[model samples]
Target: MTFSLATWNINSVRLREALVLKLLDQECPDVLCLQECKSPVDKMPLEAFAAAGYNHVVARGQKGYNGVAILSKIPMQEAGSHDFASLGHARHIAGKLENGATIHNFYVPAGGDVADRKVNEKFGQKLDYLTEMRDWFRDNRPEKSILVGDLNIAPREDDVWDHKKLLKVVSHTPIEVAHFAETQAAGGWVDVTRQDIPDGRLYSWWSYRAKDWDGADKGRRLDHIWASSDISQSAHSSRVLRSVRGWEKPSDHAPVFASFDL
Candidate 1:
């Protein structure tokens, strides 16, 4: 079966609940993976989603902090969850389908302001998180898998609007890029978005601090969908819903989507 899967960092699930419904009504992705939900499992407004025909749900959540969830129209089984860097953050969750394809939804920490880990604990933790992820994947390689989330680091120069201008920026710093690349390599994953839209300044996130976000358009492609090499060849119709970024009370990050036939 062919189905569309999408990932978005909704910022605060509670705040964007309405917008989420709107997107579901419009896009109708079979599976929607969400990051930065910022609500506990019980606190998540799942009833509305169920009403919208998205009954299958699984998530790892913490109150007022990082969270991730997968809402699907098709039934799913809980695959697993992980604590990257042992940070005790609700950042990773997985789901498995009847077809045996596993989906890992992640919310990698957004390392603090400074790039130097010595001066920034969050930055250090972020690097450690990536390291652990690489080691984990290297040891227990995944197959027929689709990974999606606000990975928080824009690894490619073309991923940012102005790479030179954002060289020292938190998300685009060399260290973050290198670490993310290493993890991807170890995981044997292919960047589905870039695989389809190979040569362009593609972005999924724009800072809310920008007075005129569209006018500035200084955005980064921090959100992504990666597939294991085995299933990467099956990925088709990849896209980023940039229009959702302009929606009413929208999340800073837009939804990244891809359709697959396995």
Candidate 2:
């Protein structure tokens, strides 16, 4: 079976329901995983997504904060969810497709502006969350799984527009990058996006503060798509829909995509 999947951080699903529908209508990916939905599951406007032919959904949400949802054209059953670091946030959800491939959608905490955990509680929470993820994956050892979402960290130098300048920044900090690398290693997850586009300054998110985001081209590869080593070889054709960030009232994030022939 061949299928395509996309991951996006919609920021607020309720406010951008139209944009979500537009993506479904246009791109029509087999599976679409969203983070930062910022709405309760009951209020997610799932009916609209259903009408768009994505009748299957697995989600965990909160009132106006972190949330995740997977809308799939193919049938899938809810696998589970986790509250990493006991932060009490709706940040992770998983679903199992009929083809036996499990999909995990996550919205990792974006460590606050300050990178120091000693002074910044949010930064501490982010690191703790990543640590817990590493431990969980180490114990669970997932296989035939695809994990995707707004991980909120740019692990590589090329992932950020100015890596040297952002080294002290929250997302590109050494400590956070170490935690991210440990988690990837623990899970044995293959970065399907990087594997396809091996060389380039790829980015999935741009700061809203940028007056001319496109012209300035200051962005970060905050979102990611990863597959288990067992199925990584089947993943290909990865790309980021950069133009979506320019859509009317769009999210700061653009959708990242990968196709799989399983």
Candidate 3:
């Protein structure tokens, strides 16, 4: 079966519920993985989602904080949920599709303003989170899996608007990128997005602080979709829905999409 999938950091699922519905109506991906939902599962508008054809869901949620959920039109069951770094945040959840492919949706912490862990606890948590991710993948050795989310790190040089200027910035910092690469290497995951669109300044997140976000284009490719090497080749049609970022009361993030044949 071939199905299209999208990963988006909805910011606050309850706050942007309408936007989510709009996306479902417009894009209609078979599977949608959401991060930073910031709404407890019970409080989320699941009834509305089911009304739109995404009747299956696997999720881990917390009230007004980090949360992740996977909504699918296709049949799927809860695979597992992990608390990397023992942060106890609703940051990681997994679902197994009927085709036996596992899908992981993650929301890695965005290290705070200062990159130095010595000065920032959030930065330390970010590093520790990545470390745990690496260890988990190393042990699990995932196959026939696809991982996607707002990973919160831009590993490639072209992933940010100004590579050199953003080198000291949290998301593009060298240490963060190194940790991100280690985590990706651990799973032997293929970056489906980069594989399909190998060049150009690609970005799925733009700062709300930007007065002219589109014109300035000071964005970062913090969101990603990855497939395990075993099934990576079957992934295609990867793209970032940039226009969605301009939607009214939109989240800072735009959805990143890819289709897979399994």
For model 3 the TM-score comes to 0.99
Any residue pairs clashing in model 2, and if so which? none
Residue-level lDDT tens digits of model 2 in 39-142: 99999999999999999999999999999999999999999999999989999999999999999999999989999999999999999999999999999999
| Residue 10, model 3: Cα distance from true site in angstroms | 0.6
lDDT of 1 at 187: 87
The residue ranges of model 1 lying beyond 4 angstroms of the native Cα positions read none
> Once model 2 is optimally superposed onto the true structure by TM-score, how far is the C-alpha of residue 184 displaced, in angstroms?
0.1
> Top lDDT: which candidate number?
2
Give TM per candidate.
0.99, 0.99, 0.99
Candidate 3 residues lying further than 4 Å off, grouped into runs, are: none
Q: Give the per-residue lDDT digits (tens) of candidate 3, residues 154-260.
A: 99989999999999999999999999999999999999999999999999999999999999999999999999999999999999999999999999999999999
Clashes of each: 0, 0, 0
Error of 1 at 161 (Å): 1.2
From the highest lDDT down, the ranking of the candidates is: 2, 3, 1
Local lDDT at 37 for model 3: 93
**Candidate 1 overall Cα lDDT vs. reference?**
0.94
